[model samples]
Target: MTGGRTGWARVPAPVRDAGLVAVAVGDAWLAVSDSSWPEAGLAALACAALALRRYVPLVVVLLTVPATVVADLVVAPLAALFALAERRHDRRLLGACAVLMAAASAAPWPWHDPDSRDRTWTLIQFAYTLAGTAAPVLFGQLVQARRDLSRRLAEIEEAREHERALHAQAVLARERAQLAREMHDVVSHQVSLIAVQAGALQVGAKDTDAREAARTIRSLSVATLDELRNMVTLLRASGGRATELTPQPTLADIRKLVATSGIDAELTGVLPDTVSTPAQRAIYRTVQEALTNVRKHAPGAGATVELWCEGDDVGVTVTNGRPTRPSLPLPGSRQGLVGLRERAEILHGTFSCGPTPDGGYGVSVRIPAQPA
Candidate 1:
């Protein structure tokens, strides 16, 4: 295991040096077994220099040169050459070291008497020398290549896992959004039914207490409805929170909304029966939110809702006089106005809301009757 900056590169220096020392000592034993004790000492010293092969490759190679020239001691120098190739992929330096080691392996042959320097012996010696030098360099390069490939593969696998995690998160978000929308639809429908029943009870009750109780139920229902609508708006604005498939309220449903609001509200002007469903829904929601605000902020203050078509555009204006009696304002996020403005802008229309000169609150929205 060896590479540019990983694999064997991560091995501690001490451990690496110890491993090289072991290899050098084994080589010395093999070389010195048949040689003189002094030659054995020199071979062992040359091999020991390999302990610092990675730290001082050139120096170790030089130290091993004299031993190799005299006794054919090669293991330590071969190890040094391998370390050099792993550290620096310099072809010229590698070629020079290879040639020097090969020449040392061949030097012993020329010194043999002329009778022993036969052509067959010369070829065998040359081939053996080249294999010894070339084997370490080529083997080191092969190991480095495999280590580098393994690292790249690991990196690619890590990137792929990251992308998969992101994709899973996105899918989960979409599912959550769908759940939110479903919950809003189910809760809102039930709450509206409660409000409608309470309104009917208020209208029919003969006793004062019964009527008051019905009014309280109606008021609470309307407040809950407003809160629900705000929740839906927030979810819609947020990404990957929910999806909705429930039937949306249109201009026809405006009557029921105003009727059950428990506020004095007047609906005026003509609402086109043939308007697009989106425009009708927008108009219906605007009036419903405005009526809710009137009940919460301007209790007992009569409000007016005007719906009209102007050429290519349809419009709705909800205006209410200031509160006639002191009223405890209902808790709200005040996102209704923001939602209305966004609705208008999305249809390339205009929306405005503020206090009028007469101290009344007014909200006006104009959207395309038919989307362009």
Candidate 2:
């Protein structure tokens, strides 16, 4: 039954209207008698008026009344009444139309003269017609109610799906915040202790080799602490509002970052202050990650950090010379460059990292001076 209704609904509106008009005309044809010109004209008017039932249902029902009064026309008036009932919500108006249709169907023609018995039969027929008229009106109202129910159910389902999505996002945000707290409280504390211990060992060590080892450990621990703090800030923010948990790096920090990188790196060039905070942060991070990689993967390598700008474009480049000594085998997650690339893409910029022509590595990122 549902499939049948769906198929019927798929029929074009004009086609359905044409089909109803055809059915109404056929009903008029079957009922009209003796080629009576006036009756036939009235019937035709009622049937043709069915074509406009969707646009003016009340007017169509009124137009069908003349044919019902003059001839035994059923389909035209009933179809119009049904259309009126489906679109209108006023029960009083529908009831009035039903009464009018019944009266029109029951009345004797003007040419007819009725006796007592004929009058009695006419009254009985009137009651029967009145009762029958209720069918189309009631059926149309039912169809209207069903359509409303279907629409309401769809709205409710959409709201429920939206609520479920919001609940899932809220749960995920809470989890990220909890993870950030754990890293800050536990992992950060441990790394801070390691850095402090390494610094103390470096200060008191008597042998040259032990002092150098302590210094290296202290520098790595401090760098790890810096990265961990940044990670915690990001997790706690959860891609929401800006956070003050850690001071975000800007262009001013680039020189300090290079100086403490534990690499013989040179910093040159300048960018205008018109550069956006996010763009500056991207520049700072690109230089930081490039230098860190140099220390980890290219021991004894000297690096050059250059800041430059062009028309509507500003960027940073970090290039390192070939390693003069063998690098230590240190475990790496290899996500730093990937993270830099993602950041660049977010800023509508470009990032590239590869070995240079001089047997060295170079990392470059270019971003807009003022992104929207």
Candidate 3:
């Protein structure tokens, strides 16, 4: 490409060069300031500007234009016509070129042509020279606009690609979360069953007093196994279709959750019919975590759970009766509520858990119905 461009540049436009020659010759070049230089020599000097016109259009106009104008009055140097035509689009060049032509034509000079109607010809020549020089500036402006538009288009494409990458990242994150939810549903149930069966085996190793404990273990095991099977079946299915995972538990699932805690409880509230699945899950986990804490910290105490929606908001509050005796172990992941509040805040929701004035502990979480 470099070689080809160099070759093209060297291959001069003969028509333009020839035009310079003709114009310079006819102008009868005279010394611009002195008005005495040999006509032929003056012509040679002005015509030289043509060769460098492409690289130095403004300069070429500036030099030849004044020289031709001054020479023209003594010689009416019209070679400036060529300079005007060559860079006619440039306003500054045209102005300089025009001044030269007027001077050259107006200066006293010998009129040689039989057709010389001096006044009329000089007037017409001046007008044409001015118009031609204005050309280069106009053309340059057009070229600049095209380049600006191209640059803007390239920037827009880059911005679009940036947005696309962000979108892809968001989709991938959502998919991973769905997979995690599926995994937990399956594993938690199996773990629960194992715990129950382990308890049963431990109890059955003893006497008649152990029968009641064994039966309790068996019941817990059966319930756990049932939950585990449903979770796994839904996950293994392909084609993005399923049936058994149908009604994943919601806040309403808290009744069974509290029952598992073995605590007497009351639940009341109206949950929104339309809520994002994540928000619903957050609520269930909150209640489940709070109740588990209650069972561990204040076991025989009663708990009151209330959940409902008001307009576009869903609220949940769980409070447990105070512990009369202080020796029970904490039943929940002790640090879990901190993580839970961080989760709620991400959706612009509120979460609070602490001891209330009545001596019991309470947890409250409110999420927007249409949370992001």
Please tell me which predicted candidate would have the highest lDDT against the true structure. 2
* Candidate 2 global lDDT: 0.82
Per-residue lDDT of candidate 3, residues 16-69 (tens digit)? 567656565454433343445565454566567666666665566556544554
Residue ranges of candidate 3 with Cα displaced over 4 Å: 1-57, 64-120, 166-248, 261-279, 292-302, 308-314, 321-350, 367-372
Better of 1 and 2 by lDDT: 2
Clashing pairs in 1: 177-241, 177-242, 177-243, 178-242, 178-243
Return the lDDT, model 3, position 250. Answer: 79
Per-residue lDDT over 1-372 for candidate 1, one digit per residue giving the tens place of the 0 to 100 score: 223586786899989888878877887787668877777777877878888777887787777876777676656878877876766577788778887877776665226555555656756886788778988888777777777888888888899999999988787666655544443434654565567568768878999999999999989987997877677666655436323345778888888777776778888898777788878867876887677667656756889988888898999999999888765434454455665665676667889988988878998999998888
Q: Which lDDT tens digits does candidate 2 get at residues 1-372? A: 122367778899999989998998888898896658999999999999998988999999999999999889989988999999999999999999999999899998875789999889889998999888988999999999988887788889899999999978887776676556445544554555566557657878999999999989988987897788678778866732222234467899888878876779999999999899889877887887787778767877899999999899999989999998766444443446765776687788999999999989999999999985
TM-score of 3: 0.50
- Predicted candidate 2: what Cα RMSD to the true structure? 13.9
> Count of backbone clashes for each model?
5, 0, 18
- Best candidate, TM-score: 2
Decreasing lDDT order of the candidates: 2, 1, 3
